[model samples]
Target: MASDLVELDRRAVLTTMATAELVTLDDLSRPTPCAGWTVGDLLAHMAAQHRGFAASARGDGADLAHWHVRPPCPHTPAEYAESADDVLTAFAVPDVLERTFALPEFGPEVTVRGEQAVGFHLVDYVVHGWDLARALGVDYALDPDAADPVLRIAEMVPDGPDRDAPNSPFARALPVDDGSAPLDRILRLLGRSPTWPDRPDR
Candidate 1:
């Protein structure tokens, strides 16, 4: 039977964010593997995403104004964790998963059914969680159930040229050694370097 994919993904995202929240003010300036985003910037972006997705689940996604990636987060860990909670609550609303999501940022001309949109968000956080973990020199481990659904979702992402666009939802899938862990394969699929930063503390 299918569990709430959104809820499963949210739990994983929260587990990941608990690590990100430990980031000190000094860590805020540190570079993340997400190209140009700094630690604080990623947190703020993730915060906006949680707010935006929650809004979208309520049928507010057509409003691009809510999706803006703002300046570095002014929030503390507790505040960021609250954002996670907010999105989880939104996803849990009865019949939310039955709606369509108008994700203008991906393509103003396109729309996705609720479960597809949740899958998009799920794979994104899976990779973003890894990005945060690598930058923080910490190990990230998702519950197997969380990682399982996400890998199926990850494979749906296409490979090659279109992914090179600055606005591509993902980078071109990265090459992986055979038999990588599901989460590791998901990272590679989203174009993240699993061994990022190479810090001794990691």
Candidate 2:
């Protein structure tokens, strides 16, 4: 089961990479769904996160330095691809699911089971993949197996003042109709508007 979950994470990551490949240097300044972050900023953060998760897989995640996001620089897309490959390789280690991941960005002593951590990683890519696609004015879709589990995980994310705090990674959850599609519900639960620019065609 853990391996299956990791496979899903792999698919999500690969999908995100595919979307990112469409980005060009000219697109770097474009704003994304992540509020103030432009495409370049988002890619830099994504690559840093990949490296951090890879370090976590290797029992070195306790170092906060591993999770730091740096300024956007030249050849960011290439760097992002390399970071994605690094993380995927690290995650393929034997017994990886049995390891503990230290996610200091959550808190100083924050730790999660490898399986749970991978789930976190999976959801991050799913949403960020959507973010990238939207910024590029393109469409994005997750693997069929991902919708249910990612939605389940999104539902489990607590909503409240914590989300309103400064530098909060997520925004406050928005309302969505009960009959909304899985991806719509998932986006709202994670504080993203499906019609991000208020377009009727979204």
Candidate 3:
């Protein structure tokens, strides 16, 4: 089951990377419903995140300060996409999951089981992929196998200090009715107000 989830996440990451690559630079500068970040900022964030994940997979501890963006270049979109693909490939390497990961923000260099670390990467990218799509007027969907685990993880991210920190990008928790579907609830739980603001009023 764990192996299957990892594969599903790997596939989702690849698909999301493709979608991100197709996004135009014009779209990157537009306002995303995500509030603070423009399209470019979001892409930059994802690129840095991919590099950070790659570093961890290579046994480099997640030193937040080590997170640096690739130097600005003319073909920024292509560069970001390539970086994302590189990280995905790194994560897919044999026995990567079995290795220890040092996430400094999470605390002193704790060894993360390979499977769990991949799961974390899966959830992060899938959600961010949706963010990219939402901001760019593109469609984004996650593999059910991948989305299921991410939804579970999203549920576990309490609407507390982690979600409400001073510089947190996530919004305050909104009241969701019991019957809301997992995906919708998950989006709302993570700060996206599920109602599509782009729709015109009849």
Tens digits of per-residue lDDT for model 1, 1-202: 1356867777777876788777988888888887777777777777777777877888888787777765544645665677778888888877776788888877776678888878777877877777777788888886777777888888888788887776444666778765988877887788776777663211
Highest TM-score, which number? Answer: 2
Ranking by TM-score: 2, 1, 3
Positional deviation of residue 132's Cα in model 2 after best superposition, in angstroms: 0.2
**How high is each candidate's TM-score?**
0.88, 0.94, 0.84
Ranking by lDDT: 2, 1, 3
Cα lDDT computed for each candidate against the true fold: 0.75, 0.87, 0.69
Q: 45-75 in candidate 3: lDDT tens per residue?
A: 6777677777888878567654555555533
Indicate which candidate wins on lDDT.
2
Give the runs in model 3 whose Cα sits over 4 Å from its true position: 70-75, 108-111, 166-169, 199-202
RMSD of 1: 3.1
RMSD per candidate (Å) reads 3.1, 2.0, 3.2
RMSD of 2: 2.0
Q: In terms of TM-score, how similar is model 3 to the real structure?
A: 0.84
| lDDT (10s digit) by residue, model 2, range 122-194 | 8889999998999999998767899889989989989999988764557788886779888888889988889
List the candidate 1 regions with Cα displacement exceeding 4 Å: 72-79, 167-169, 199-202
